[model samples]
Target: MLMIKSWIYCCLLTLPPILGLSQNLKQEVEKRIKAEEMPAIALEILATHLSQASKIRYYKETDIGHQSFECKFILDRLWYSVEFDENGAIEDVEIKMDFEQIPQAALDKIRYSLSAYDRYRIRRTQRQYTLAFLSSDDLLTMVIKGADELELRYEIVLSVKKDGSWTTYEMLFDQSGLLIEKKEVVDRQTDNILYQ
Candidate 1:
């Protein structure tokens, strides 16, 4: 009887987080922060590449259960963002892109992938770079220099009209326009996947 009681107690103790997991899965929050608030390593990495960068902004972002820091700026008239994990390890870099930026074949594939929706209105498009098989420095270099490499992927935000209702979604497509992940936005009005 005591053993059964202890097992029940253990399950009850862990039940809260499991129950909260569903509520937490799609939650994301963004807050503007000062440069000094960024991790030292992230700041050092940014300083190396932000020589002529302008309009730089620092943001602390929380997604699901993970926290990250991002530095966004305009470099050569293009918006760029560098994200670092809570531990100060570089995560990825993103650059704003346009429909025309996607390769012709890839765009066709991307369109085909979205054909199921009645219509998908694009809200935002960006090229994401991560240190997949390369070092962070190398990945950052690829991002700044516009070098299309292995770690490149496209992150797109779209509003889809399906079943006569509009729903916002954030989609990630690989460099070849293959669908990676599609996450539905909880609330579009105040949601911030990437800064506007």
Candidate 2:
């Protein structure tokens, strides 16, 4: 019994952190809000493209000790998600896109990378724009002009089979399908009231 107890203790100690739990909070609520409630910087950047946008919705993400804002809208029939830091600086802009939209070379690379897994299913894909130190005016111009000059990256979510188990992971890849970051999707927290 002692040996069994020792094994259980080891297993519990080495367990990985919960997949979906952010480092900042046990739970996070992404609540939608009015555009007017957002900071001036974020609004100004958004205003440049408002002429062609539809169904614009703003959301504020508040974790225990972190805050960020996001605006999602449809532009020219394409879905766009723009995230801003607390200071209203553009963090990243994501455009929902089809998997086939990836360039041939990048698609090939992504397939090769996925080959390591036993099996995988692509869930979603997005084209992400991240410009470094770009002025609001430049961003406004670039966004309004369809982002043709920007180097966009692909963000993909997939359910992958590894070691005979299925796990969901969010992966970021450059235009060339080079791996940038991989994070496992965590499950949502259970309600304590139900258990109690």
Candidate 3:
């Protein structure tokens, strides 16, 4: 009985350290996630952007400073990727599509939509053209143009609302010097809600 009691005491003492290690690991992951600045709101935002047929193919926690969740999804023959923090905020979004995959009719629709806006002159080089548009209040300025064929990129800088939503009145064009393709890369709120 004495020996048994001693063994039990030893076992109980060991349990605390084991439990502490587990808790420490969890905390570490959480800390890493927060450090990456992943926003929780991004999850809902991304969900709204995907289509009904889109399915999550891969998801894993990244060790990149913060606890980041890298998720890949397939929708409408496009591959989409979203990185989120542990708290579920979106860190970045990437959409991959081929120029040949987009219908010319859809591209035309995108160009026609841009005609309504007043365009300001943008700097141009031999290969690319750029344009800028100011928001109604002149608080936001959007520059749109082309970069390259394989990638369509947009850089936006705008003010954030108190609720964490961005107030963006600017627009960006694709590497083809057209605005139609921008919608294919970025997920809009309507896309988000509809996808959800």
Candidate 4:
């Protein structure tokens, strides 16, 4: 009996993350934070865009083992999320938009890839901008002008089935729809002490 239990445990540990056995699956947790909780450097960078931004909100986001601060707001009739690391260094900025915002070529490629699955539905779409050493002003300029100098990527969250079970995945693709990374999303439930 002891040997059987040990073997089962070992097998479970070795299962792939997509099988829902891994503890470190991609999960994002966000909590709204006040200006006092934000780092000065991050605030300094954000000041440049405050003139045109409305409905601005700050949040601290945690995903897997990383933590970052985010400023979400509306600018130029578009929703934006600017992220910064613990040290207030800019990481990347994301714009929330519909599938129609994606370029035609990229959209075609995305559709072609989705055809591989039996069926899939896109739940969310965000365009990511990453450019190293770009000051906040420069970043805002690029965003406003729709410049192509920045690295643009698409993050698509969709649900697909495998082995008779459905799972959610976050797929990252380059501007041309070339896949950069794919990760399975894990559902994390809040603890309810009353249930225990």
Candidate 5:
């Protein structure tokens, strides 16, 4: 019992710094919300701009530092999710995709990056649209028309085996599949399950 107490004390003192030093952990929680609970403009934007989408569901997502609203649905047989800020301004749109759907160049780069691991499995993949280089309306239009006018990115959740241990990672890649960021997923065995 004394040894266990000492070990606990040691962990309490050392854990914070260790966690802070690792800039590569992802944590989030999401809960379902009604359309009325979200910003009015968000629903208006969806009703006016993305009317073609079906089976829409709303969620309030809380991340490490911020919160956002999300609308997930099926659009033209593709599963898409749109995220909005608290003010209802568009943030990004994500389209779930299969490995075969990713561009060959991006796939090659992603493959090379994961090769360092003993084994890896892609858990989730999404093609993302954002207003980084354009206006929110323009980004929304791109979603409507399926336009590829701007640079593209891929967000992936991956489980990898390294040094005989398995860890989950959240990775972002540019259109060419060059890794933009790589973070370990924390809080749960995986990142937040946005929905069932």
Candidate 6:
């Protein structure tokens, strides 16, 4: 009985340290996620939403502070993407269409449209750029024109997916906080876009 009691005591003494180690690991993981600004809860939400889909893929974390999830309904030949915030809110939704792929011709069209405004003269004041989602595919570029006359130019790329979804991959903002140029490159083979 004495030996058994001693063994039980030893076991009890080891249990707290083991539990502490587990808790420490959990805390470390939580810290890393927060430091990285990853939206784990958001991924969970997206996973639930796409649970019924036939195929689903996830991309790397976005620089814009959101996580992206791609879903494909093979039976319906449909594909879409959903972006979520750190807290798991549905930040954006994209619907894939057949013409989602942007051919070289469409690139020329975008260039033409943006080229029409050569001399952008905005006030020489400070402004802020805000991210706005026009639709699942369309990210509206917004900025406040400054007080003085400001002249600037830039190029931006908009990624168009097969389901007619478009997004701004990357953008450049001038001093007045106006977007001068933007470039959106779509990976047709992977249905992913690198917004640089």
Number of the top-ranking candidate, with TM-score as the measure:
1
- Model 1 segments beyond 4 Å from truth? 1-25, 188-196
Q: What TM-score would you give candidate 6 relative to the actual structure?
A: 0.31
Residue lDDT tens for model 2, 1-196: 9999999998775564444333543455699998788988899878868778898999999867889999999988889888888888887888898888899999999999999999999889998888766864475467657867788899998899999999988899998999999978765557775686
Candidate 5: C-alpha lDDT: 0.85
Q: How close to the true structure is residue 104 of candidate 3, measured as C-alpha lDDT? A: 67
The best candidate in terms of lDDT: 1
As for candidate 5, its clashing pairs are none
Where is model 3 more than 4 Å wrong at Cα? Answer: 1-40, 97-196
Residue-wise C-alpha lDDT for candidate 1, range 95-182, written one tens digit per residue = 8989777989889999999999999999999988888887766677777887754667899999999999999899999988999999
Task: Write candidate 4's Cα lDDT for 1-196 as tens digits.
Answer: 9999999998777776648666654568899999779889889888877788899999999987799999899998988988889988777888988977899999999888877787787888999987666875577568767887787899888898766677889999999988889988765454674465
| 1 or 4, greater by lDDT | 1
TM-score versus the correct structure, for each prediction: 0.81, 0.77, 0.29, 0.76, 0.79, 0.31
State the lDDT of candidate 6 residue by residue for 1-196, as single tens digits.
9999999999998988977643332110111123134356554444434445665554434343334332223223544444444454545444433222323454345445445443322212212222243332222111111222323322233442334443424444443334555544333344355443
Q: List candidate 4 stretches off by more than 4 Å.
A: 1-26, 162-164, 187-196
Which regions of candidate 6 deviate over 4 angstroms?
A: 1-44, 64-75, 99-181, 184-196
Reference-based lDDT, residue 118, model 5 = 100
Model 1 poorest ten-residue lDDT run: 187-196
Candidate 2: worst-modelled 10 consecutive residues by lDDT = 16-25
What are the Cα lDDT values of the candidates?
0.86, 0.84, 0.42, 0.84, 0.85, 0.39
Please give, for residues 1-196, the per-residue lDDT of candidate 3 as tens digits: 9999999999897988877643333221222233123344554555454445356653646443655665566656645555555666445545554433434664455346544544422211111112223221111011111123223333222222334343333345454435433211122349666776
Q: What is the lDDT of residue 195 in candidate 1?
A: 66
**Which pairs of residues have clashing backbones in candidate 4?**
none
How does candidate 2 score on lDDT? 0.84
What's the distance in Å from true for residue 192, model 1?
Answer: 19
